[model samples]
Target: MSSRRQYQREFVRTFFTSPTAVEGDDSAKMLRSASQLRGMQAPDAWIPDNEDATAPSMREEGVENIVEVVSEHGEEFPGEIHPRIVWHRDDPSTRYEGFQQMLRIADPEAGAVEHVDGFVIPEVGDIDDWKKADEFFTIIESEHGLEEGSLSMSVIVESGAAELALGDLREEMGNPSNNLERLFMLVDGEVDYTKDMRAMTPTGELPAWPELRHNTSRGASAAGLIAVDGPYDDIRNVEGYHARMEENRAKGMIGIWSLTPGQVVEANEGPLPPETERWLLDVGGSEVELDDVEGGQAYDGTELGLEELDEGMYRLEDGGEIHELDEEQLRERLVEMVSYVPSMDDIVDSMAEFEAAKEAGRGAIAMTQSATLVVDGIEVEISTDRMWDEATYQAAGTPIALFRDVHEHRPDQHDELKERYGPEVVERALDLDV
Candidate 1:
């Protein structure tokens, strides 16, 4: 909270479909407000005078200002283009189209352009691919006479392979030889990740928590780059969206994408203080200051060494391999080793966040006593206290509807509700997923 805003690894995310060239000036004919950004370079870049008529200043009729959003979040989330990798695979030309979009997004010869700030690259699978991208952009910048770092870049990791290569990705980004910006981890990679693990349930939760936890921490912290997280997919699931952004914030991610305009409020929230913040103050194993020894391993003693092991990971060794731990595992062991009592304020804050999280997740399924609920005149025993057991799921009587949280309409089965509730109830029932 300073009078002058700080320039951290900032981001402001918004995306608009590049208007189809064939759609042209007539595209603005449907409009009240400008459908196109004036003064922005076209996604196809410079137009051939004979073939193209729309200028860099937008079609004259579409010249009225579009809505502008200012971020009160204090962190600048400047507008940027998201260059997707699928285009690269589909055809090289389309990928370049994305690049053209990036170039024109913010660069305006006239007045202030559309606040274009940077770019985020999606689905980087390996270091080789990353290096190629780095070089590609380097050349592109040179060609455009754009100074280095003028247009920033961030990469998203969503696939399982990309998940594993996160360490290498961060290491490469931090290598100084490369100019790749932040690495963001999308938590619910959904089917993209699940298809590899073959383990995702219908609810879209990745049971592999460590796969996610370490990705954000290692990428965001180790590489010292802005860590970005997923846009909580459900636009209407405000509680769930807030809870997720909080988790991302706790993991040190500076930003989360907004799936809808409303969800930007959740992404804008500052994180509650991180549970444990540490630095390798004593590099060569020296004694440091100490407070009341809490649950963490008191490290005031000498012989503590934090050194790089594999890329993107540091080992906390007490002089040798006899006791070595990575960041996440090390924290767990320290918690078990000591009961470092935090100040009452810290305790209160932690508990409050904990309860809020519990409320957000389990809050959907209200727990009450057993009751007979009739759906379409069919009586079914419904127990709010206990969800449907494995036996109940298998029994296959009248569709056992435990839809309090909308779990019954599994991702694969849409009409199951319609099949059970009949046309009348189906018409009247609230959309639980909403």
Candidate 2:
């Protein structure tokens, strides 16, 4: 098994710094922002960006700023800090400079070494290129007398070769000298990737290469590492950002590159289950009302248009065809209509109920959820029964695991969780066993 530290990875906010000081200020902008991030609550991981975010002329000073600020306040920062180091697939001199900076920053004498989690290497090419970087890290650890594999590594899939390199990690893990197991996240960098591919668009905008995102997620899952999507540059479009997050969540990519603190908050809360219950239905590719009924059609019981047939029956109507369903059949149909994403409270309640059942010597049980709607002043009931076995319980463990990780790593978010889920539920979640 891997010895790398595992924690919830939701938001990665890159702190960009410039060498030039703002007018009327004595220090660089990066120092001021780094100090501010020490107290922020949203970013689960912070990246002190020294690559694209910093001007080429100021990179040396940028490294100094990282060493100074991180050494000063990193111990108090709640989030994991991974500084983005300069690197290139084809250039040796740039990689050498990055190595020298790593040596300086990771020196045991530097107070920042203990607080630094790892480094983010960008513009990676292939598996060989990856191993070269790993060797560099290994040498750094030995030079500073740090434990082997003590510092984790995350890489950006910015080139086609890097995209293909992800598939080779499992095989490479067997090498005795390889520290592939210490990898943490596979982050997407679409801008450079587009440049690498020589791809273009009519409007000169980066194409949404969804296949790349999916492959990144699949690769991360296979390697048991976190997958983070590329940054969304349209920061002002909050709705668009949320929409992108929804798409990423569907692709099993829960973490995102956040450019601002507000984006960090959005990404931090994006992967978590909703605060309240939500059920949606798609009828003929259109969303129809579930609570209100008109024209003798409603979607209360299934994705197909449902109409009340009798006291305990429903008619499944689609394109003028009808099929009658009895009470038991309608109950099963309701299960199909339940496009339900469980709330945090709902998950905790289910886990608690299952634990009680286990204590009573039961291996499995059926959990029932019901919904009541009043249409035209007449009450209608919709209900579904789901089997909760060991498998089901294990599958439901993600949200609970995330909650526990947050409680353990992000103490600043504790009060927010308490306010959202109440102190009792939060406490139980932290104490519960999977």
Candidate closest to the true structure, highest lDDT: 2
Q: How far is candidate 2 from the true structure (C-alpha RMSD, Å)?
A: 4.8
Q: Could you tell me the TM-score of candidate 2? A: 0.84
- Lowest-sum lDDT 10-residue window in model 2: 13-22
lDDT of 2 by residue, 1-434 (tens): 12234444533333222232233344456555755663333477788877888777777877777788888888777778788889999999988888887888898787788878888899999999998899899999988888888788899999999999989887887589788777888999999999999999999999999989999998988888888898899999998989888898778787888887777777777766567765555555565545534432234444346557668777766556677988667555545644555778888889989989999999999998767543333344666678999999987887677667667777877777788778887877776786
Compared with the true structure, all predictions reach lDDT values of 0.39, 0.75
lDDT string for model 1 (1-434, tens) is: 01121224222222222211225544433221212222111110111110012333452222221112111110232223232322132246645654554444333342222233344455555566556556666665566555655554555555666666666754566577776653332322433455555775677664544446557556556656555554455678887766665565455554555543345434432232222323222324442333323332234444554454575455555455445556566444433333222322332333334345455664322223333322122222333232333233232211112221122212222354345444444433233111
TM-score of 1: 0.43
Residue pairs with colliding backbones in model 1 are 11-77, 12-77, 12-78, 294-339, 294-340, 295-338, 295-339, 295-340
Candidate 1: stretches off by over 4 Å: 1-7, 10-94, 103-114, 174-177, 181-191, 195-199, 202-210, 270-434
The TM-scores of all predictions, comma-separated, are: 0.43, 0.84
The numbered model that scores best in TM-score is 2
